[model samples]
Target: MNNRLRTTLALLSLAALAGCRGDREDAPPREFFPDLDTQLKWTPQGRSEMFEDGRTMRQPPAGAVPFGRRAGVSDAAWASPWASERDRFLRDDPAYFDGTSGRDAAGNPVFIEKLPASVSVDKALLLRGQERFNIYCSVCHGYLGDGKGTVGVQYSPVAADLNSPAFLVADAPQTKDGYIFNIIRHGKPKPDGSGGFTMPPYGHAMSEADSWAIVAYVRALQAARSAATPTTGGSR
Candidate 1:
């Protein structure tokens, strides 16, 4: 209670306060952080965080997602915070395939896209189709639509016999055109009798016009195969 005692106590209190402040300076205070008004400003870890019940703060599990959300897949939730990473390695990115506008930069299905309607039996287009098929499709469907390609048998589910009437060389070329387009555009979701999945949709690699070109060529090839059935196969 005397002057010296009082002075000593005040100095000790000040020293303790300074020590606490120094410790705080080294590491920002975390104990009191939760009580702050998080609604006003969010720190780096708070931007995409969600509050389960307005109190329980939750973050998407690392490599996890919410309901109706694709965590880290090609077809995952695009608007999620971590989408770019998902697409980097997908065998087929849906964004790259779907939501396209055959004309516009982004596919929106806005205008009457004419790619399917525009294709014809142009020799050049048909030739292009032939070359492309030889490279992409022939490995499985065989050069003559027979399910005899080496790759076809390698698959767990063998490829379909394209020469079959249900699929190939239909009596009417026009009817076959649309069917062929569907096969190329969406691919056979289920391979016929065979188990191997059909080729993924080529609607990404080639334009719709090119798809029809390929169809036309296949139809022509089918006709040729039928006409030249000498019990001999030399490839049309």
Candidate 2:
């Protein structure tokens, strides 16, 4: 063959060989599907990191001490300074909060005490008032209208002496049933007292009928406090 024809044939042969190269990218990767020899021999354990003669090794021996051991876990305890406890949490609370049903046996809402001289109520209402007062008020305000309740002794600012006439004096319009109703609905907040703690507002806790009934009973309590105890100071 002439030199040019022979060169052309050689170039054509090279292109055919190039196309047959299964190792090229478009050919499915040999690494993707391993041959029998590679599959049997290649394994994760086949490769390993070697420690050269003078190189510092990273892995510690099985029983070797950890260098610069991590700091020990702390065992210190902590508690909040302002934690508050409930009355039930401590048995010392005398009242101990026996709850009221807020209703009489007849299903009518009732007060925590008795009716005043100005107003008369049925026996059912009076009985219900007595029960409510026994549940709520008698703990701080005495059952006898003396403000000397079993739980009152524990108070930081001593309980008011309800037996004294002056206690009612400041409650001007004290005679007014409406004023009593106001006090019951929106508890009297004491501004000057040792405790700004007022009686809890019954506005949300009790119905209007119940609030008025409580006012009526409280007036009775007030009247009881005003009751005279005749003192015949030895016939001097």
Candidate 3:
């Protein structure tokens, strides 16, 4: 063969050898661009030398407000849903979000006597409340709100009987809708001011709407119980 033909054949042989790279091996494959293959990233709970605390995750800066919607966003037709969701996240309404109209003279929260205007009492809302109650509160409060749940019987003080006179009476503080809502979300702290709760807070697992819905369902249960036996009171 000519020198050119020999050179071409040699080049073809080298190309064929290069194609035999599919064999699996224990060692990591060679990376032509190491920077792209091995990127610099901080995983969750990973250590970092850059920070003084040597933590990959950093706390939010002091005075840093939680981000919600953009500044220019308005309650226009197209942006109404977005604005509503942002407002819910912001929790700017005291009566609706915090379940308190204002604080009393002694700095104690003054819960609203009735449900806030934002919450509409309807069949759909009651159904939602029933579902949420069964999932979260029923374990301790019981499906009937009688504090006779399987887990509730095991508790030291036992869960409150939601259908009792204390909660259903018109003049009783416990009858306040906002009070119930707050209890459902924040839970009751020990009377001694010790950093402990009688009822664990469900705020983390549910949204404000769902919490309010539970309150509504509880009221419905009380009403049904009252109607079923006009003269008979609910037992604790």
Candidate 4:
């Protein structure tokens, strides 16, 4: 072909390529994938004409439970931390999650006397418990569990002395591992049944494993106190 014809054809091709470049225009552009631009999904806090409530978000079904990570993920080496977290969310074990093994004849929850088998009672767990206790419990229970913390002194009904015999003796109801674990997570309810609590629950802020760790630490403190106290000799 002639050089002038070739130059004209090249110019036309360049112009066509420039037109394909996306740019602001007064007219609406054609969309090859309309779904990508306008998805068939409801936006958060948006109104929906299809539903009777006209709200985009719907309430979960009655008795519905939340699902967490799959059990298979627990087998992975890197997912060990998440494995424990998954168990916490699932809460299948009553003793570990609720701190109660069963109910007594009167229907009162029977708390377990020892920490669950899943929990590892070690120096690391105690250290973690100490750190968490200092941050949360020490404010009321005192660093030594003596109910003499700065905030405890000012509290209306002063915090309980955790080192007291009621909480130290092995057979004491309050000394049960599950009892302490439950108290740490669910707090103590007022006797009046006025929907009030003597102490506020910490389950929202703390994890189940951490609650168990605190129970272990509280036991350690009670044991230390018992050992230091000079026993009275009966005969000699």
Candidate 5:
């Protein structure tokens, strides 16, 4: 055979042998690049010799403001320096945090009488409120906000009827928007005093804005039902 033909046959035989790699159980495969084997990175807490400080983690520069901090924000939004617990509480407005309307001259705790100015009653807010209410609240309060939800029916006492005039009044009102907001933020208190949760607190689950949205959606339901039904004297 010619030298070229002999060389070609040898090369073809080697190529055929390479193709049989990893075909048998005893034949372990090997990677020329081994990309995956070398791709692992050091964890945050892991030590490294790359820096003089010997830290894989990076430290923020001095006086660097945290993400999303607005310049000249309200004092209530900012934390006071070296403030005590009582002092911090005093700094926070009761209407905003605890959802209270302060006190009456008789030394009784007065619940909120109106909705906060911060809550806008526009279409967008109402829609968002409705969406949140249906997802988190409708199972307990019903889509109509009539406290006839399936879960509530299983309980000894049904959920609070948001359509009730005592809570959601039309021409005249008694309960404040803050009262409803408070209820949504911190669930209803259980009578047993077991210290176990009654209605699960959504305050930890949802944002303050989302809780207010639910309140708005509830008011929307009330307004819709009241509009549909005819009223006789002061009774519905």
Candidate 6:
């Protein structure tokens, strides 16, 4: 071919390549496979003609029960030998339900001063409590129950020291098991009701039995810490 014609052809080929390339900086690329986008489907509150009700959604089957819930179980079936008599005293005993002990001279409801009758301190119970405490409470309370946990250290307000005398009321009076159970079930709120950094309640996540177990574990930790500390006169 002639030189002029070859040069013209090269110029046209370059222009075509430039057009195909387009601009590097632009909007996001279009979908390569748009089949999913175009597929027919019914979204929430959408209508459909397949059902007699002419609605896309249908009600759940009658008597349906959610996970971890009992529907038709009887009280007799749930009762255990380990359950405290106070729990069985009335239909719902205050000790098991509200964590109350006995009323003082005042009309106020006095909280129980000890562990639930159902819970007995044993090796197995302590082990279970230890496992649960490490999983949930240890994040803020520390593995040693010293309130120096990783998250607690960085927290704005320091976490409570489970081993501290104030925690178990060691000097004035011993701490009550029911009180601890209540705290675990209903989380501790901040001094002010502002509600940002307070401990979250574990009632929903952990069962009542498990909550008791955690309380047991905390008591064990306190006992151990007390024994380890040296008295003024001699070592523990």
Q: Which candidate is the best by lDDT?
A: 3
Q: On residues 111-170, what C-alpha lDDT tens digit does candidate 1 reach at each position?
A: 221233324557898898898778777878788867677898676567766666764334
Q: Please give the CA lDDT of all the candidate structures.
A: 0.59, 0.53, 0.86, 0.84, 0.70, 0.74
Writing each residue's lDDT as its tens digit, candidate 4 over 127-202 gives 9988988899999999999988899878768888898878755677797899898888988898899878787789
- Residue by residue across 90-158, what tens digits does model 5's lDDT show? 545566555567877997656666555656778898889888888888888888988888896666567
Give lDDT tens digits, candidate 3, residues 90-110: 877899898899899999999
* Superposition error at 90 for model 3 (Å): 2.8
User: Clashing residue pairs in candidate 5, if any?
Assistant: none
Candidate number with greatest TM-score = 3
Which one wins by lDDT: 1 or 6? 6
Clashing pairs in 1: 99-107, 100-107, 101-107, 157-195, 157-196
Check candidate 3 and list the clashing pairs: none
lDDT value for model 3: 0.86
lDDT of 2 by residue, 1-236 (tens): 69999999999988976676665476554453355544333343344345454334345565442223223322233211111122223322221121222556897433223233324576666666666666666787778656688886566565555556654564344444554565556666777876555555566766555655565566667777577888987777
Worst 10 contiguous positions by lDDT, candidate 6: 65-74
lDDT of 1 at 78: 57
Please, what is the TM-score per model?
0.42, 0.39, 0.63, 0.61, 0.53, 0.55
Ranking by lDDT: 3, 4, 6, 5, 1, 2
- The alpha-carbon deviation from the true structure for residue 55 of candidate 6, after best TM-score superposition, in angstroms, is 47
Q: Where does model 3 exceed 4 Å of error? A: 1-76, 228-236
Residue 104 shift from truth in candidate 2, angstroms: 36
